[model samples]
Target: MHVLPERIKSLRNVKGQSQKELGQALGKSREAISKYELGEREPDPDALVLFSKHFNVSSDYMLGITDHIENKAFGKRKPYSPELYAFEKYLKNQDFIPYLQLAVSMKDSHLDINSFKNPINKLIKQGKKQKHPK
Candidate 1:
């Protein structure tokens, strides 16, 4: 039950979805979704089923029975990568969503990570200054 709230929030953030977006997709209101994440309310069995289907995760995982979010019935799920997970957290913490979107858009456009070096450096400097102002 505790894990249900955490998993819901984690999955939503990982998918870059706001509560309103997820609620609309699931036919629930944004406030309901908020309550679910806040642990103020628990979803019914029907809502649980919808969540599993929408997130491609198993209900057992959502219930904290498993650490993996795999749904074998759907197909062989890809294993989670710790590095990718860490990078995702880093991006969220650093508020890099816009830059990440820009980087993703540049993909297959004959650009490399090197193309973002200057911007990345500037962002890092800004973060440092914000953390420790003179």
Candidate 2:
């Protein structure tokens, strides 16, 4: 399946948009849109992000990882959640990418909560030690 091309075309059709119209909306060229739908080129990250946002679809769906258009697994995310808000602030304070990688790795690992406790506590201790060494 030519996922990107097909998906782009399908989404454009659903939105009742011509390639030229989509290009105008996205500040791109009609030729660019044609190339994307023809699978002659792939969209850059920014363009992909734009498309996902504009269509209210997941990047996974746009990339063909999932058939579902909306990410139902995320359960209709609100604009804000207390825990996520706090976590985002925490990430902003810390080295975001490394912590993001760690979080993703842990989530992907599916370890038991008990199993995670020791590693998490060790990281906390390390942060404290770095903050103030005796």
Candidate 3:
């Protein structure tokens, strides 16, 4: 069986949400949700993102690309750490060539990747301060 249909149905059932309710939450029609669960249709990318956000599971989990439901780094929770989420989103949307080049340059310069952590952490702290100013 295809994992998408099974996972969607299972997650809906586990959440005690009827197809109508799930559809309402996802801005999809109940019939559409049923079709998805029956494997008669596959969700588009937008719907897939909605499903992932609604269920708090990774897209990989929904597609069965990975068995792990929650990202170990984030755990199963809402309001994921903004800094981490932003970084993750950035990485997902970016081309890897620049990153690869940077890595090679860093190696040539004898720079440790770990050295960036402190500066990144400082920026995160600065962002928090700005967001929640005293």
Candidate 4:
């Protein structure tokens, strides 16, 4: 699948936003948003900028140039700590599907990291056993 359409659709779904709502926010018609997500039409440069700003993501991410979402250069958020940045870099190098699934599960459950300890440890043990069979 083309990265742009999939990214747009996924972000919208994750945000629980309808195409009409997104279009209204971006000052485009709902049809335009639908077209953009369907890959039948492309957002102009200005609309693309609006999307990046609206979603607080980098334009490069919206355009599929990078997988990192935050528009560090455009936003006013505090700088990422060195350790946090390192962790994020490491995650970027790993397979993303599992992380995405974990994120969705966490969001749905409203659970904190502490709540995942047992499951995580079980997975770790399973991995070790698989690597060093009896």
lDDT of each: 0.82, 0.77, 0.80, 0.76
Residue-level lDDT of model 2, residues 6-107, one tens digit each, is 888877876778999999999999999999999999999999998887766788878988766563346564343223444565778754566577778878
lDDT measured at residue 65 in model 4 versus the true structure, 0 to 100 = 76
Tens-digit lDDT string for candidate 4 (1-134): 67778877877775668999988888888999999999999888998889877876778878877666664565644244323554665678645557667878998988897888889779768867987999
For candidate 3, the lDDT comes to 0.80
Winner on TM-score (1 vs 4): 1
* Candidate 3 TM-score over all chains jointly: 0.54
How many residue pairs of model 3 clash at the backbone? 0
Q: How displaced is residue 80 in candidate 3, in Å?
A: 20
Q: How much is 96 displaced in model 1, in angstroms?
A: 15
Each model's RMSD to truth, in Å? 10.4, 15.6, 12.8, 13.9
The candidate 4 region of ten consecutive residues with least summed lDDT is 76-85
Q: How well does candidate 1 score on lDDT at residue 53?
A: 84
Q: Tell me the lDDT of model 2 at 51.
A: 84
Weakest 10 consecutive residues of candidate 2 by summed lDDT: 77-86
Q: Write the number of the candidate with greater TM-score, choosing between 2 and 4.
A: 4
**Which runs of model 2 end up more than 4 angstroms from their true locations?**
71-134
TM-score of each: 0.59, 0.53, 0.54, 0.53
Positional deviation of 125 in candidate 3, in angstroms?
51
